[model samples]
Target: MPQSRHLATELPGPRSRALMARKTSAVAGGVGTTVPVFAARAGGGIVEDVDGNRFVDLGSGIAVTTVGASNPAVVAAVQEQVAAFTHTCFMVTPYEPYVAVAEKLNEVTPGDHAKKTALFNSGAEAVENAVKIARHATGRDAVVVFDHAYHGRTNLTMAMTAKAMPYKSGFGPFAGEVYRAPMSYPFRDPEGMTGEQAAARAIAVIEAQVGADQVACVVIEPVQGEGGFIEPAPGFLPALAAWCRQSGALFVADEVQTGVARTGDWFACDREGVVPDLVVVAKGVAGGMPLSAVTGRAELVDAVHTGGLGGTYGGNPVACAAALAALDSVERDGLLQRARAVEALVTGRLHALAARDSRVGDVRGRGAMLAVELVGADGLTPDPALAAAVAGAAKAQGVIVLTCGTHGNVLRFLPPLTISDELLHDAFDVLDAAFAATSTTTASAR
Candidate 1:
């Protein structure tokens, strides 16, 4: 009954098993789940399953619930909005909450330039609209992306994403005119390649393959989220942004997973003073409410004629209210500082683990967005099986962890910013135990 994790039964116990059976029958096969247990309640750092098992949440619902899954302020705002009205379709009736949320986004997002904001239902929708606006403004055809990037799952975003298998495989004939550029992954880069050199490499390819003038936008996740939490080499982002400006191509920052204090900054671009032309935001923006947005230069955003960029449920009144509350919580609660503290706590432990375990290849990321890549005995070959074993081990011990990366050899940790230091340390304890156990088991098997 305590807030901390307490297992009354094995994971996916009798009640959870029954619900899983029901879910299998009702939900489509493509809709995947990380854990078998069904959540009955979740708050702070713990999720209580239907069978009375509590888990320390490290994934934060893939970085959506930064202020906590059941933040009181967000809940109150949603309740108040619902009491007034649910939805009148913003395009038809229009509401103040939607406008207020947009105004907030314009104010908080980087840069002092004249800015405008448009809301959407998801990260994919926001990215799609950003690309649309860029193409319209530039009158260009091609969009540029990067390797190991994860934009979203929609057709246009799928084309933007770099990985195959789960995201792109079988979903072919993707939207055309999307070009992929090499990213500056520090851990995997050539021995002496500087960030500037890496940028030049990608720029050279962009110029030759996708003419700069012919490109509409160069979209990137300042800190690649689903792509192994890859933080570009120090100067990589600044160089890319500069090139985009010189080439008359807009630089878009997909901050879906890194925005709203997740990376200890308003946006990951802020770390290097790289102010993107267009910023796509979601995930943590609404405190788990379904809301996403595109905020950018007023001129480029207004380039599209009226009625060209809106959706019926794009900025649902309820969701906007939640966003407003969530943003307030971010600033009021000082979640930015908390995110940085989490980075120090997690990365410090991970670095120690790397020293002990050969399988732990690299630990990287900013603030609360951190990851440890698993490697084989050679210390260079990706060991996805080890990552899976570690994650599974953590889950079995009542700590929720998630794995990511194109190779599926990275363990990503995105605990809510509101999580207590005690809970965070406890989760790390579980992860350490998981890694130790997995290492021994693998060695014995070998």
Candidate 2:
């Protein structure tokens, strides 16, 4: 089979089918999967299934492998760290790699305002900790989040998330004092509403309903990840940050999916020159290792008591070692520029597709994180069925694509930064074919 993408048999071939049977009995139903074929190995935008089929990976394991799933440097670092020591528990006995990773985060995150970092095991934990720090620092209780936001799965974060079906359904007794504000979704926003105007609208609600003085922090994703990869209108983020500053509310940037050179910048907020008081990072941070962090102003982070913020696996030495090496790969490999290049290729193709198909209502996003919102014949009604059909067609053709958005009518592309140009273009070709196939079927059904 070719290194790029080759199918020796149908998707979820014999070996994969056998594995699926085992997984069905062992794994819980709630833990879903996109592709049924179990991966034997993955690297450089290609996943090889146990059945010997190769697939082009457009979904970089949901953007967790920005530096590639098995980056050599990260692998070596993990190996060395495991050999030395896996986990002594940072709270029990601190290690050099943990402190070093925190230092690196402080230096790289936006602003030179004497930042500090607290590591966690996942984005949700980091977000929960950020809320804790904010409340402690401000002596306020209310925490503000945006509509179309996806924080995490923890109880508090599930409350922070906007969507209700899968993430919030059946879960109850959520954290209180969490206020939801309207996001600056340009495509859905009223026509001619500038970013500043949108910010003012959300701020008005915050002031009126939540009371700015009662709010400790206003947490938002500069480019919302699960909310259809929605990039806020220009000037929107800066305006919100300014309001947070004036109103004495901490501004938190949930960059879990947008950080680590994923959005063509160190952080998406950097594009707008918006320096958030607190930034949550995960997913691509450690080259697929389970690690997350909250990096923020010194005073706010230090406001917590000496033993206030920590977990047993927070800043695990192995994960920290992987992060250090992954950071080096990002800088040395110039993945930031590469992410921009990917945006150009993907957006160009998606925009052309929209021109040819009315079902593609909007093509938007930045860097490697892009999405196309599917609509019905009238071009306004969301067509989630079409999105699902397109995604299924692509998957059958050995291209791994992921669907997201509040309505599940958006097809998001989050290819690894290290994906070769040839492979990326091939994946787009598969997508184009998928859209074409799905559109024809839809027209016939109508």
Candidate 3:
């Protein structure tokens, strides 16, 4: 279907409100929704709620629908695969689709070196397994992650993740041997701190505190997602990768939100030629299907014992089929170029907004994955209130924007590559009005 934003009624119309009431009664409070309006259909860039509201899909189901939510190829592949077989379990009766997906991941993920791939049910699972493989391979226990990093929600990942509020609050007794290091946040770093210097600072922390030799891997998101769409300054990733090589630690890229052409590259690390020893991928990998993978060096991955890896539903045939279709769409539809086009269009508008509004503290990210970090008058204090105000306003106006960052102050954009430029511009119109209205409200309060 053609993409366009249209609100037939007030946000979360009566029908949606009714459904939400039922949801509250039946669902866990932790399972949240950005908007109460449930989706009836989604195609191109529009997610039509049950109440006939067509919202511009800026979140892309949290960056999972990179090929659009209802791509014909993905739908057909899924249907065909489901008809043939749902699951015999890859471990029990290994399937061709699983092998195909692993082959494709090995081909596309950064680095020409001989690589292997292990598929899983979610990004967190892939990350956990990656750490397991790295630890076993390197014979080291300590794992280093950067500040403002968001690995996942599982016990070990929660320990690796830096944030403590929504992701970590009440989820305690996290796994051990996970160490945190400073990130190369150019926007917050001291004036004139180069990426190399920032990398050196992080390395110093790892060496002095964690001891480089004890490190099994340095895991990082090439462009942070939940911790804000932070793009570490140039040379940051390479320096860490080099250090990993020197210290016999694996370099791991948590490209869950920045991989599979979402960043205009197969993986975000490809942008600077920083190939990781292991690449953990999810979100956008299977065109909305729940699938993730740990793809990297064959030697390191194979080092794990034969029965050391895998889950029962790790590489479901249906999800693998969907992934194959999604991969095909990336190459055939030129989604890599499409992502860059999105970056140009959205980044231009975001920068223009930042130029005029001091609240838009920083505009950063790559390709369709972009964000506007909100801040107070000092331009340093995070303005999560304003960010919430803008996002809430945009959702009401039919633009489905999402908020993130450890401070909850970053309005992140993850539009589908298939979105029409007209729809994007229309969403931005709502965003512009939202910013202006919120600014006026805050000004009045002050």
lDDT tens per residue, model 2, 190-306? 999999999999999999999989999999999998878999999999999999999999999999999999999999999989999999999999998999999999999999999
For all predicted structures, in order, the TM-scores are 0.98, 0.98, 0.98
- Per-model RMSD to reference: 2.1, 2.1, 2.1
The all-Cα superposition gives candidate 3 an RMSD in Å to the true structure of 2.1
| lDDT-based ranking | 3, 1, 2
Worst 10 residues of 1 by lDDT: 437-446
On a 0 to 1 TM-score scale, where does candidate 1 land against the true structure? 0.98
lDDT of each: 0.92, 0.92, 0.93
Alpha-carbon runs more than 4 Å astray in model 1: 441-446
lDDT per residue as tens, model 3, 1-446: 65777889987899999999999999999998888798899887889989899999899999999999889999999999999999999989999999999999999999899999999999999999999999999999999998999999999999999999888999899999999999999899999998899999999999999898899999999999999899999999999999999999999999999999999999999999998999999999999899999998999999998989999999999999999999999999999999999999999898888877888889999999999999998879999999999999999899999999989999999999999899899999899999998884332211
lDDT of 1 at 53: 95
Off by over 4 Å in 2: 441-446
